[model samples]
Target: MTLRTSAVQESWGPTAVWSCAHAQGEHVKFFVLGSVGVSHGGPVLTGGPPQQQATLAVLVLRAGHVVPLHELTAAVWGESAPGSAVMILRTYVWRLRKLLEGGEPGKTGAQILESANDGYRLAVPRGSVDAVRAEELAAKATRAHAAGELEVCAEALAEAGSLWRGEPLAGVPGPFAESQRSRLAELRLHLLEERLGVDLLRGRHERAVPELTALIREEPLRERPYGLLMRALFAAGRQGDALAVFGRAREVLADELGLDPGPDLRLLHARILSGDPALLPAAASPAPGRGGGLPAPLPAAPSGSAPTSPAAHGAATAGGPARGGAPAGLDGFPAASAG
Candidate 1:
């Protein structure tokens, strides 16, 4: 049977399982928000074997899309795939379907895990997947922040941040898992930076200092965090510390990369030096609903346009992934092909 894949946009509510109920009103829930794993009802499901788990991870990473056989094999076994790779993969798919469809023994229908033309697709309802829900919340956070509804933005980001239980796809070994883990980690960092921006904009400069300091130390060469630190310090009336931050950033950039600070950092440094009143954090905007409330659902990119990747927002740093390549040791996989 041919099952066509489509984008599922519904938000995840408190009931975090798929709408597909079984004999007892329970359902299988597949989670990929943090660790690549699955649980049915209350207890975590197990006994699929490592290779099978790796196969499931590959499919879950691109849930709702058909990942072709060759691509699956490439992700799972890389260049060293055994001659029986295809057969082995098929067996893995069968096992996963059984695990997911365990409610009905010997069921022939493709309800959750459906077979596509040349690949497989896990057909869970919208928001059932934690990663998808987190993405939606992050999108909402972006929208709320743009509208200057700092509280709403913070709320949304907090919810999004809570979804991550640990490193994504943890313990699932493969090039695909490695790359996805890096991508998800970078996305989380971007979300954290966004929330930090909201904090600074809402005049929580002092409160943001500790977090920004930690981020800067963790990613010393990341210009955006350094810039944010400078702004936060200046807003906190520690102008000397702010300037010292700029000086240290300059030295680090020059010594490590044979480069200088980017224009944004340079401009902030100049503003701090000049005591620009604009450098001081503005008074917090009124809460949402009191002449507030950012519009629901952020604006979409123009037709046929791709939203910018997180990497494009900043310069490549010393220990981070380089431009346009699956993080070091993490081989890239093709985007999910339409089922």
Candidate 2:
């Protein structure tokens, strides 16, 4: 390999030795998953007040994109921002810049954070933020699941789940952080469900049952987990238990929310009652015209959401919590009226 290096290329940090991340100079890795912090090739620096962390969280989320002051103010203080909110925000930015640089006055000039015309931008290196990495992995899982590459999908989702440290954006104070925290947490749940689905496909239904049951307990109203649990139980030869789960889901929805199970669950119940052979794992992902005419699989994931299905059992959602609506039927089968 001939050497054709330029002065500007050298200024962009050591690119050739990426295997060591910071093989030469100090590099930064911003994290938004669990707690908001940065790793400067050593111990993570998580020393900041809640509001400061909130500011960093917002910029970290929209990394590489400019965030205007007005938007930042709204995220940081919602509708109760004090008159000096802007000044305080600026101070937070300065403190964050110093903290990332180890507080050295003349640290090498590699400013990851920049202020442009009317907003600030965070330019952390790609794959440096766990949240962003999770999203990317989720996308990979989604694609694999869609293409019937169950093992690959499971691996990607598993890797994505491992990146989360704790409660996302933990201890960060701001509307933006709160919203993002909820979003990231839900993404993890969806990925978990997807992984479970892959396990079910691989004839590991016994293992999926307990996990799905626990997920249902935590999110009783989420119909997706309920459906997956039923599938696992039914696959493990607990047909009666599978139907009982449907009954429990119906009861919970009726008692707590004054709502019946969505069409997705209702249809799944009907199919299970009919003993649809397509529900069998061996028949999953069968050719479109074969498999006894089972319904089509889930649709592609929506933009800006988790790259996987919103719900494991239906076209309910692959990104976040399923909102109340006209949902499609269960995976691998068509819709049918509840029995």
Candidate 3:
């Protein structure tokens, strides 16, 4: 049997799994989206043993690349690995192949895990792993925020948040899995913050408080969630609660980082103390006019059209052309002003 179709190219889901597996054997591929499914002929065999799943997790996380046998064994067994680690790994691989091929209990499975001189390769194309898809959704959500597509941004963030079945590489123990877990967790936090930021901007503060409170509980050291909590409290007409939240944040920062809160937090504290009406979106700015104090006008573009040096330009106009027309490189970021 063979699986072939363009549906595999669309947004990943059960349908995409079916399409990818149903194509021809020529298009056969392994996909580990929300669940494991073999795509040789429309998602035939699904599921795998714990050890086999762990082995595939390491490879899929590595994503179509050779993972050294030693490294793979270490990830699964840590320092007390068995003497027959290679044999055991081979057995796991054999089982995974059988699961993928949909063969009878005793029949041979498809050839998915390819052996290399020192390791094994997953050998699937890009976008086959659900984790990869989750990361892609996160990146797209970030871009949507940058582009000011707030509603779409929230949906994308939610989609990214939904990718995890549990702790990544769960049951797998090693430095690699630990690092991946930490990185993915941090990204999840950032996406959550982005979603909350959009909701706060839209004056949906009341709806954000519960979520923000839970987030702050999980990440006490992160000031962004505290800031959102404060905003939500202030908007909800609980000024005292908002002030208490600020105090808590200040104490946590001092205890954890031995430093004071950043500019945003300091500004918020002053606003609360002085009763800055602008703190509440429904109120108008306290200043004479609606416009906040505008910074100095940006310098004129470098004349002579030779491409201004990004480094030569002042911090305010980092996006503008270089001041001295030097070769622009990554180091061309404008200097930031001190508060």
Candidate 4:
């Protein structure tokens, strides 16, 4: 059966919903983001053996592409495949097709799970897979953030963050799943950092404080989150608390990594100590003209007045090389540098 689209007339206009082009399409849905499983348009399908599920996990991780038989066997069996591994692999594929397509063996079309020249391919629509959709949203968030559209950036990031139900590939065991679990988790953390950066730029310091605090507690050794927490505290008029946070972060880094806090952190500490007027939140400056160099650094705020937040003042300037021979790493990532 082929996948079919149906047009329905509505009061506003005509709308379309995809119907089972295949007789059984209405009953089948496949998923692999949080776990490897199938749903017949309702509850998750079960009763398939673990090995079959592992095979399916590998396929889903590499969805919309070809996964060779040998690679599949290694992922499922690791280093201990039996002589009948190929036949057994074929069996698992057949079982998955049965679950995913609701069709008999050898009858499922190339539209869903197809036997390619050298491997198997699962053909599904873009964004049908949750992980792919999350990545797409993250890309959108990155673009919005770059354009200084903080509201759009936050909304896209929130939607992307919502896609994770739990540990990705949870309960699905294999080399492929194991590796991908860590990779996806790291990507999620990066997205979170990006979101926090946008929040700081948008003057959401009070809102960012709790989230950055929790992130620092969870990952004390990571430098970026601590930087964010410090910035948030300072922006919220908690200068003492911000300095204390730097002290604690310094302790964590020195204790764990046997290294001092980086230049960015040191510069931020100096600014907080002298109460630099650049730490207050303000509207971002307009983008530089085409081929024009970065905007000049914001002038220091008047004494006793709210200073522009370091993120806002430096965000545009940070895109260019550090002025006056500052470290290269301090340019892009937010951290107060010498003024």
Candidate 5:
């Protein structure tokens, strides 16, 4: 229940193994059950060569799924990877396992770094990594926002944002992680925009101005942020300053993306021009905390609809075209159902 410690029970063969992740202050333990209940305590990792740590961190960050071996190699070596890349990767995994398990190299570590058909997978529990927790919080925040729980949305958004200690998978780079990090950054900005919208709706415009101003600097091309900035400025009784923000956003968007403002933004600009306050929705006012966390359960399998798992989709891949035949970056997105 507490983020620091989790209770895990596993049924194996004819035996059930239960282990508790007990944390003593800053100390951490990873418990597992297979042949027997094993506890990995006393510094899951220690300081070492930067590259080795980066490699292990990347794997840990993406635990519970395979990371393409080629992707992990590229992440560590960039373009200068030697011809014995696979051998070197094996060595790194060997060393990292020794460090993590605090036991003989081949046995404890081999179980963790599982050999999948495509590459390798680190089978750690969810919430074991901060990255997983942050992703979950962001998903929850997104759901709360969509459900019209503005105050709860803001709190969850802030909690999700607070989880990022720095750049995601910091000091690690690979095509998959790069794409994932970009998506997370975009999600963060969207969440921030929603949070600011909630604050502005609550007439906390004065308090929101500085944050919105800083956000505009970071996301100059994002129209929603600019709109919020304008609203904040206007509400703070600085009409001229607010209009100036809109003008700057217009110039930046035209110069950069070579496109006109979107409909929502153009409408906001027009309202600002005509001094028509009716364009602002009355629902902008922040409702006091309906709750402070993730949203309720999403609608389940709409009536009699059958749900598909990722493993099933991966199995379906065998009947589909070869992997490289499709466009890149489309694998993760769900396909449109023909039916």
Candidate 6:
């Protein structure tokens, strides 16, 4: 996966992941978007043992940066590390160095992994790591969206989404792996919302419905998805269903969080109640005024989820995934306004 250098700079700024230059040649491709492993130049498609893989995962996540000895030990064995932990870590690094450098290195004899401050840095070429590449794509997508290039934005986010194979750091045990997994899951959600926003802007409301539905089911308390789903459903000629969506959102918010919908959501409810033509798909009608920008929220599926497809992005679930329940209604919603 190729990434734009500008995007890398945009995302990381002064503290980028590793390299800004897109270097080439015999570096092995590292993957942590799914399983923790490496490929290209090695006989073993995956890397070494569980602990070794965990060690490498720590390095891969911090690729281009030094990983201190203490952090490495915690990533591999947590606080219960044995006295021989240092020796084991060095041994793993030695084996990983060989594994990463096993392929041919004729003209471009790039260093795979290096040691600094007695710390480790996996110095593979830029864009060689799927996780890093995905972030670059996301950054690019953000730029494209800012430029009003809806199709380009959607494509870049979709490409980023496709890099995921499964649960991040799959089968790799340790605190680092577990934490990174959750972090990446959050990124996936942001990517999904980005794509959905583009789709909605491009007048793909019908297309956004299923995802919005799944998102609402997964995150009943979040108002953004509910708003998006309501818009999509309203534009699809299901105003009744759209109203029902607000009903569900109200129930869930009241029950789960013991709160009423915020100003944005209540105002949206008012607009829908007042028959805002701006809610129509953009392709069918022009939005004549301001104060109509939408928001995002998602949930309901068991994720380690992948992006919807090449055109769309992904869905991610979070804590206390909603069950089939809602609370009593609260009053004082915003009043409908005449535009």
Q: Which numbered prediction scores highest in lDDT against the true structure?
A: 2
Candidate 2, 255: how far from true, in Å?
0.8
lDDT of 3 at 18: 23
Q: Estimate, for each residue in 134-170, the C-alpha lDDT of model 1 and write its tens digit.
A: 6667667656655657688787776666667677766
For model 1, give the RMSD to the true fold.
9.6
Q: After superposition, how far is residue 101 of candidate 6 from its true place, in Å?
A: 2.8
lDDT of 6 at 78: 83
Give Cα-based local distance difference scores for all models: 0.61, 0.65, 0.56, 0.60, 0.51, 0.62
TM-score attained by model 5? 0.63
How would you order the candidates by lDDT, starting with the best? Answer: 2, 6, 1, 4, 3, 5
User: Which of candidates 2 and 6 reaches a greater TM-score?
Assistant: 2
**Model 4 lDDT per residue over 226-299, tens place:** 77778788878899999999899888877776878877778878977877656656433233563333433423
**How many clashing residue pairs are found in candidate 3?**
13
Consecutive 10-residue window with the lowest summed lDDT within model 6: 330-339
Ranking by TM-score: 2, 6, 1, 4, 3, 5
In angstroms, give how far residue 7 of model 1 lies from its true place.
Answer: 30
Better of 1 and 6 by lDDT: 6
Best by TM-score: 2
Candidate 1 yields a Cα-based lDDT of 0.61
- Predictions: Cα RMSD each: 9.6, 8.6, 11.1, 11.5, 12.0, 10.3
RMSD after Cα superposition, model 2: 8.6
lDDT of 3 by residue, 1-339 (tens): 222333433224423332224212334444443344444444324446555666766776675567889988977677888899899999888777656553222223444566777988765543555556556665665566556576776776676665554454454444444555555444455556656766765578899999999988877876667767886788678889999998998898888878777666677777776665666654333344655432222123222212121112122212111122232111111111110
lDDT (tens digit, per residue) of candidate 6 on 94-206: 88877765533532223567788878877655456667677777767656655657688788777677666777778888777676776676556556655675677677889
What TM-score would every model get versus the actual structure?
0.73, 0.76, 0.66, 0.72, 0.63, 0.74
